[model samples]
Target: MKSILKVKNLTMNFGGLRALHNLNISINKKEIAALIGPNGAGKTTFFNCITGIYKPSNGDILISPKGNNEKINGLKPNIITKKGLARTFQNIRLFTSMTALENIMVGCHCVTKAGVIGAILNNKSTKAEERLIIEKSYFILKELGLEIYVNELVTSLPYGAQKRLEIARALATEPFLLLLDEPAAGLNPQETNELDELILKIREQNDISILLIEHDMKLVMSLSDNIHVVDYGKKIGEGTPKEIRNNPAVIKAYLGEEVV
Candidate 1:
């Protein structure tokens, strides 16, 4: 079980305030790992650092896409995505004016080889690549059960479907590791359950590792192969779901009570 993502001595600072403190975490190949904590616990900050949205003040963010390790601390976000890491935001960030298919095609840009010249000249290779992008985008829509909304604007889709579309776009990037940020936010119980199933399907079908920051306890407990709990920018617990559910520190800091 090789780790696809590894963070060592991760720390983030905002002036005198420390958002994250010497945090260390990892997600293994094809595993669904959850980062759980109360709000403002630096979970999202950690994600931002790893994704290159904010360069960490101190630490190493390492990613091994296919068993080759590389430090990604200072890489740009798009560069990180091209290195096989893609993420969704806590709030949906779709191109509202774009159709669902087009939104996904936007993510495929990193993998496509068409440069400015190719696009202007409309060469055979560029045309073929454009067709492949369309074809692959359609396949992603179908795979996520979003074919019905393919031609619809993201603004017009239902809330749950909009969430799915965000994930579909991330998938279109062909990520080896997907970082989901509070994906079940604002969903009804039925929608949350649907998301749970969809996440499982993603793991099994795509064989992609997942590292998610979620506060939805049921979804996290049920979906995660391993759970890491953070409190006030420090790791409070890390273990299997069952172990985390019973850990006294996790209960006191975040869980508040026994999970069962």
Candidate 2:
């Protein structure tokens, strides 16, 4: 299968501080890849670059849907999203006042071509879009086991439920690839398990590729088909979960030297 997303020699710098350095990553079509590292590692920086929140100072980011060799590095976030890339942040970013269903309906706005006037007038120019959006959003809510809370105010839901709602919002965008930053961050064991299952189901049902940056090693190892490790702005290792588990470099980076 073709590569859905590609990053080569990616670097992000803030003044003299380099957050990501010469990072190279590639995710194939319909695959799930994880980025893992120590707390100060450049995983989040790498994510920002890919999602267009940070423009790479040097390197290339390519997406296949728009054809190869197209430079996507410096594109704006919304532009990149329009090109079929979508993401959820490390923190839940919901409209607190909106209901769970409304949060998802907002995501559907990007893919729908209805202009502000069309929406205001409720014109036929957008009726079909609105109908499809409602059906798809409801379907996504059901897929995430969030149907029961669809009408509840987002702020009133549990923390984990709020996070899952964020995922539902991203899926509503109809993205070809999804980037998840620590979706399991604040969840309990049961909630984590549900998130893990839902993530896999997303790949299976939507055929969407995923790039996840997560601190939970168990969750990362279980959900990722491949893993990349970073340390202080640079990639130190990349391999299967088993390989990463046994790598001395990875252990030392995360835990320092173990006294024998």
Candidate 3:
């Protein structure tokens, strides 16, 4: 399988501190991969580097979109998104005051070709594009089971629905790779189960590869085709779920807690 994302010797530095060190990881096309580690293990830092939130101090960040490989090291976040990589923050970053549909439309902005003149003149092309955005946004919401909150304010939706809305907004970008940061955080047992189903459905239905940073052991073990364990900014283990479960280093570093 061709890897959609590849990171080689990736490192991040914060002044004198090293946040990540000589890290290497990859996500194959349509594969669901998980990045698991203790808190502050630089999981989110790795995501930021891949998504262009921060430029890595060293190494290459390459992405293969539709088998066309390119280096995205210094590209801006929007440029990376346009290159078929989109992500949701660990924290919910939705526009609370905006309607759910409107929030999703924001993601569509990257793909939309409308200019200031097109918007001001309200031409036929602009109108058509507007309609297309609405249709696509609604479709994403429906797929995520967020159709009921389409017209509601983002802040007014239930917590789980709000989390799904964040994902829906990312989906509106039509990414080949989706990066989720702690997506199951703050959810109840039922909500976590639903989220697990939703994630599997996203992979099956959209045919998009997913790379997530999650601490939920059950969800990670069940949903991930492969797991990469990191500790103190370095990878300790990488393998199938069964191998990861039995790996002593992974157990001593992370899974030793409540993970089984």
Candidate 4:
């Protein structure tokens, strides 16, 4: 299988404190990969590094959206999104005042071509682009089963629906590789189960690869084709779910602990 994202010798530093040390991870095309570690394990740091939120102190972040390798470390976050890498945050970040449909339309800004002048003039071309964005945003909402909340204010939605809306916004970016940060963070079991099915459906229908950071072991093991474990910013274990479940190091560090 072709690789979609590669982090080689990745490291991060905050002052003299090292957060990540030579960490390496890879996600293949159409694969569902999980990065699981305890809190303060530097998992979010890795996502920030790869998604251009923070430039890595040392190492490379390469993405192959079209089968051609390109280094993305140090690029702006928006540029990275445009490069077919879109991500949701560990915390739900949505426009509280905006409607669900409008929030998703904001995500389309990266892919849209209308400029300030175009918006001011509302020319034929700009109007057409605006219409297309609305149609596409609605389609994404339907895909995520959020069409019912289309005109509702984001803050009016339930917690689970808000979480799904975040993913919907990311999908509106038209990414080839989707990075989900703690997607199951606050979901109830039923919602998490729904999210599990939603994620698999996303991969199958969108033809995209996924790399997620989640603490939900059941979801991780069930959805992931491969799992990478990190502790103290270093990779301590990596394998299939079965291998990871049996790995001594992982058991000592993560799996052994009470999930909640």
lDDT of 3: 0.93
Q: Tell me the tens digit of each residue's lDDT in model 3 across 22-56.
A: 99998999999999999999999999999999999
* Candidate 2 lDDT tens digits, 1-260: 67878889998889999998898888888889999999989888888888899888998998886446567889999888888888898877899999999999999888888888988999875897899888988988998888999899999998988898898898888888899999889889888888889899999999889989898888999989889899988889999999999988898898897722
Tens-digit lDDT string for candidate 4 (1-260): 88989889999999998999999998899999999998999999999998899989999989887889999999999999999999999999999999999999999989999999998999999999999999999999999999999999999999999999999999999999999999999999999999999999999999999999999999999999999999999999889999999888888886565633
Task: Give lDDT per model, in order.
Answer: 0.93, 0.88, 0.93, 0.94
Best candidate per lDDT, number? 4
RMSD values for the candidates in order, in angstroms, are: 1.8, 1.4, 1.7, 2.0
**Deviation from native of the Cα of residue 231 in model 4, angstroms:** 0.5
Model 2 ranges off by over 4 Å: none
Q: After superposition, how far is residue 202 of candidate 1 from its true place, in Å?
A: 1.2
Error of 1 at 207 (Å): 1.4
TM-score of 2: 0.95
Q: Name the better of 1 and 2 by lDDT.
A: 1
Per residue, candidate 1 scores C-alpha lDDT tens digits across 153-214 of 99999988999999999999999999999999999999999899999999888899999989
